[model samples]
Target: MRLRRRTFLQGTAAATAAGLYAPAVLAQAKFKVAGIHASPVENAWNSRLHGAMQEAAAEGKIDYVFSEGVSGTDYGRAMRDYCEQGVDLVVGEAYAVESEAREIAGQYPDVGFLMGSSSGPAGENFGTFGTWNHEAAYLAGMLAAPMSQSGVFGAVGAIPIPEVNMLINGFRAGVTRVRPDAKHLIGFIGTFFDPPKAREAGLAQIDAGADILFGERIGTADAAKERGIKAIGSLIDYTPRYPETVFANAMWYFSPLLMAAVADKQAGTPTGRDYTPYCLMKEGGNDIEFAPDMVPEDAIGPMEEVRAAIKAGTFEVPVDMSEPT
Candidate 1:
């Protein structure tokens, strides 16, 4: 239930030791798979993608390769490299370089490409998927709303894109769910990897009366801990690092769905569909977890109640992001 720091070398070593780095299997496998990312391998979001790949490769003789630290000018080259490598399935999150990826995908007809982007599947062999993380963020906001002493919650985000906007909007909705008059102080750091900027934004929000903070990227929790405010983590749990300050976290499980798609592709299914997979309460894709060290025992019941409502279709979390008049 907490974020564990891992180095890219460590992850690569583990994968290699587990037979994932086998070049023979990769070269002659019935289906070769590759993952590319704009974020570094050490990042929590990218780590989850790595974890998913490791899990999916467990049952089959699939060849697995990865490209990371890819962005802007380098994205096309990376995509082309995978295509030229004769990889059967290529998966990645193209945040800033979506257009570049689309262009590259257009050039590779035999290769199946899946990207986590705000854009469409576009090309014949390309597909797109994004996290329906707003639902989980809203739940985290609801939990933070009552816990805040200042009656103001803060959200530190990356890039202000639709992906990030939904999360911020969801947090705001959750806060309003519990405290109708709650005020949110939001900040955008423009880049996903800049933990220092995220930390600064969090600090600014804390200084502006925000007693509960939402950390969309890596460093916001450090700022929250320093300021003695409760922090809600995104994408992964961070309670292990900031046990006292982190109240809860929202987790996105991307592997199961990706593997399911891989199975479909292996079975000769068509690859042109725009598959937007979601992790709702029923699907077990998204989660709101409380820090064992911080959250009170009595709060679990209400949280489960809300979760059940979401699962049973009784409670719907609104995801619209239009500003209020």
Candidate 2:
């Protein structure tokens, strides 16, 4: 979903128009939540967070507010500002500013800090979660493997961080399961949101004989659109935007994780825990989306069966965190 960027809420009137702050529910007002996005809300990662917050706000669960396009250096300032605003829970990424974020959380013991992090929870308020969408990524690979005529696929990612590494590794494993001899080309553009660089990497891989590209970043689909090749999207479905190019997507829903944190805050319990499990396929945190007409008939049955097996707890997608070469 494309979300319009929301500038940070300013002053005491930080609540949305119909937020819990209104006297209408002062007697049973819900917790106040604030999101501090390191990237644009429209980005794959931030969109999930923003969407969940939007959904919660629509349901009148809490008074929700957020700020997008917050740079890494400014992350701490954002966190402090939200905490000082009397927000009960704060959501954002702590990958680049872990120490500063941790210190801030320590300062505010009452606020719940649910951050997208590679590390574990710190203190009593800071909780962490990784983008655990590998199960769906594996499913994506199972369907995508058969489409590569060159027996070589390309993966364009932001960086080889643990979460990114694990997802790509799962996809690669699924590709191998389908085509034992299938090879892959991997590229990292160093930054998370540079679409042009991702596209360039995808184009380079296409030139190197890759028939299908896994767009772990935004612009890979653009290369596929230009080359008229197949692609798989990461985090969110790009099929609507790149209908002809993106056949499948590894989708992530941040609601399960956020609501759990919210529950803790309401219950007066610490939210400091690893929230990775909430993103598992069984928890409705992650799943796969594929266009039936685009999937090969032969690949469809197996993919569906695998998906069922995963949700049934019979099949487990192995998590491999090693960086791909």
Candidate 3:
């Protein structure tokens, strides 16, 4: 579906207005959850987290609050503020301030911290998670391979980090799996939220003979739309926004991880474990979004088989962290 950036919630005000913070039962009112986001809520990554919290709040499972635009220097402070406010669970990404966030968690032994980071579990209360949606991306790549007429694919990403790299590599592997001689043109905008830069990179790639694009960044869809080319989306579903251009997406569902974290907090257990497994395809953490009109009818059955293999644990989508040039 299409995600409207403007409707995205910011923090406390947004949560309450959306009626996403009411307690389901009297006993469930004790658990409070807060998210500290370094990026705007509209960002695909953060939006996944925000959407999950909203779902939880709507179910009266947790009292959810969030803070957006949290910088590296202020991340620790934001976590501390939530903890001080008696929030039971604090969620965020610590890619820029890993040490500071872990230190804050150490100071608050009772509060649970689930963050997105490249690191592993730290203290008794601190844990990290990744989107781990490479399988879905690989599926997207398989779909994109046959649709590409130029035999060249392009991908524009937020950064060259492992999380982004894995998806790119997965997509690449899918493309090569189908079109053994296909060439990939990749670019990184260097920042997570720069649509203009993503578009520029996409345009450059298109100029260099790419008929399809892996839009790991925001503006790639726009570029594809302008050029009348096919696109595969990542992290979030963009079919609603670019129904005519984007045919498939590798979507990350943060709800599974969020629910697991809440369960741990309710059980009086610390959430200091790598929750990446909760983000796997089998855990309902990730999936591929297909636009039927844009997909070839002949490819449908095979894609479903691939998805079945993944969910049945009969197939494994490799996790490649190597940078895609």
Candidate 3 structure, TM-score to reference = 0.90
lDDT of 2 by residue, 1-325 (tens): 5443454444224666545345335424667888999888998889999999999989988778899999898999999888776788999999889889999999999789999887889988899998899999999999998898899999999989888999999899989999999998999999987999999999999999999999899999999999999999989989999999999999999999999999988888888888889999999999999999998999999999999999999999999999998
Full ranking by lDDT: 2, 3, 1
Could you arrange the candidates by TM-score from highest to lowest? 2, 3, 1
Residue pairs of candidate 1 with colliding backbone atoms: 3-237
Give the distance in Å from residue 88's predicted Cα in candidate 1 to where it truly belongs.
1.7
Better candidate number, 2 or 3, judged by lDDT: 2
Candidate 1's displacement at residue 174, Å, is: 1.6
Q: Pick the candidate with the highest lDDT.
A: 2
Q: Write the residue-wise lDDT of candidate 1 on 107-176 in tens digits.
A: 8887787777787777677778877677788788777777877798888888776767877898888889
After superposition, the stretches of candidate 2 with alpha carbons farther than 4 Å from their true spots are 1-28
Residue 31 displacement (Å), model 3: 1.6
lDDT of each: 0.77, 0.90, 0.88
Worst 10 residues of 3 by lDDT: 19-28
The window of 10 residues in a row where model 2 has the poorest summed lDDT is 3-12
